[model samples]
Target: MKLRNLPPLALAAAVGVALTACSPSEPEPEESAPESASPSAPPTSEAAPAAVLPTGEPQVLATGLDVPWSVAFLGETALISSRDDGDVLELLPDGGTRVIGTVDGVVHDGESGLLGLAVDDQGRLYAYSTGEDGNRIERYGFTGEPGSLALGTGETLLEGIPAASYHDGGRIAIGPDGMLYAATGDAGNPDDAQDLDSLGGKILRMTLDGAVPEDNPFAGSLVYSYGHRNPQGIAWAADGTMFAAEFGQNTWDELNIVEPGGNYGWPEVEGIAEEGDFIDPVQQWSPEEASPSGIAVVEGTVFIANLRGEVLRAVPVADPGTATEYYAGEFGRIRAVTASPGGDLWFTTSNTDGRGDPSGDDDRLVGVEVG
Candidate 1:
């Protein structure tokens, strides 16, 4: 389920009150999360549930999760996911979960929490989360608690991502050139969508350590592309071109090619054929068809996870930047999806947190073998 709150974030008020009432000083950051390899990634409290995959499934590689948010393959047999609350779990193909510990102090208000996640080529796990301050990306060692990873001190990989009740941009991924690309939301400020200085409402490319890559569209800056309302999902095909999925205000949602310095009109434009120097969406849809979130391009197919639509929509990408939808309506409140090693795809459902009533299970992790 998604969390909803008022626009512009009442965080300053809420945080100030919390601080004055609690600790007056800046809160100490959490220690790195510790990793565990006990076969599964679930908290020890719940017993493993039965594995559930499509009937003609690829042998249901695994199952039994506690609100799995984002899934990324660790090796040939294991993967990792984050619980909506704060717990991170490492799942095994045998349907078992091991609690890898929690990312402490993640303000789980509304549509925020442990949202977007990625494990880079270096085997480092990166998580874009809602900290007490706002939204940020933190990197971790592949196997431990938040503090145990390389950036164990919770070093800010990227900071100042806009986080609101409903439209917090949370997805992030490492591109082929070793730069970290992130999708961000407008934080309910339409004007902010056009502001390059504000980190909200844009796609940013930065170094793994949060530093601006030298060759970024804007020199010494992180903004790779701008003009987005709530760009939540990002993906890249084999050729290294980038594409992003955006949430619309009311008119239409969009899928756009993320070009360097490109502005895909927001506030200024909503759906189709808008004027000005803005790039239009390659495809558009009503919110019911694609309240899209996490995205993964597997074997030329863009797998987009829809939060409201409750489906996994696939768009085939023959050219790196262009695509056309091929499959839709196959999942339920899918919040996160990713391509696993060896050509399999993993997706998570979001029915428990507060959306539609989960099918008794609330949330789940399913594997898809894409063509």
Candidate 2:
């Protein structure tokens, strides 16, 4: 389809500056400041300086995409996955899109369809999608370079993940340890979060070939952590610390530092309980202000994309207790965000995902530089 890209730096100079909220109350490490999480006062940390915030407005890289979900880089080239039709699109130099290939057997409705995409260091492409059988992850072989890209038949890596209209955790990433980590929701049943035998409500890890690693916490299993409600975002700090964002029922949402075999207290608790029964989130917020979806760690900062809150948030790694918000309500709903190969931050909007208001220029892929 024909899409348009505005001049790279045009938007920043042409439009007025966006409002940025860089509030850091406690400066303590967010992992230790769960007590500060509340609707009136979010965890505060000023470790991230104002200089790290994005400079100027985000420029539209490509517009007119239909319900785009995830972004992956095959070198400098950007590939986007469509959540509605399961098609993979490659961005051209001229700002248009070419269909690389369509994922077959993807069943779409509600929050299900083709959701996440990842490219391994060896050039293999991985995707997470929903099907009649359930949710599954498939690996595909890639041939050719940017602009002339091609995807071979998909090989199902793992299948039978619990799926539902909501809580179908679909984010997948290849960790620094070269293992595949996947986030799965409770699939509408909170009890499943406590069931070790079920894959739902846990972050599962395995080899690239889909076999459970011998060193996994549970013997002969893929469950990395348990007791999660609807975790959709996962990332890692440079020091090898793992972080995740989870959606709470109605009271609070969470950001947690993940540990192997750790229990995150979903049905038993929502936020910081000061109890030892389960792991508490480092920071928590009301669902009305945060529906944190996709997150990426960049240059010591964690950037998050929120669906219901309609903002792109930044959390400093040094003191996660603090947060800086950008583009609040300026763009409809942000679904995906990642660091581009060229060192810029790229994100997508979710207006066409049925939960947001869509404009003629909605569902765009935008790129911006983070100072």
**Local distance difference test, each candidate:** 0.64, 0.81
The reply for model 2, stretches above 4 Å from the true place, is 1-35, 38-51
Query: Which candidate's lDDT is highest?
Result: 2
In candidate 2, position 273 carries an lDDT of 77
- Highest TM-score model number: 2
lDDT of 2 by residue, 65-175 (tens): 899999998877888999989999998765578889989899997989998999999888999999999999999987777789989989999999999988988889999
Model 1 misses residue 102 by how many Å?
1.3
How far off is residue 346 in model 1, in Å? 1.7
Per-residue lDDT of 188-245 in model 1, one digit per residue for the tens?
7778779999898888898888898888989887899988998878887666657788
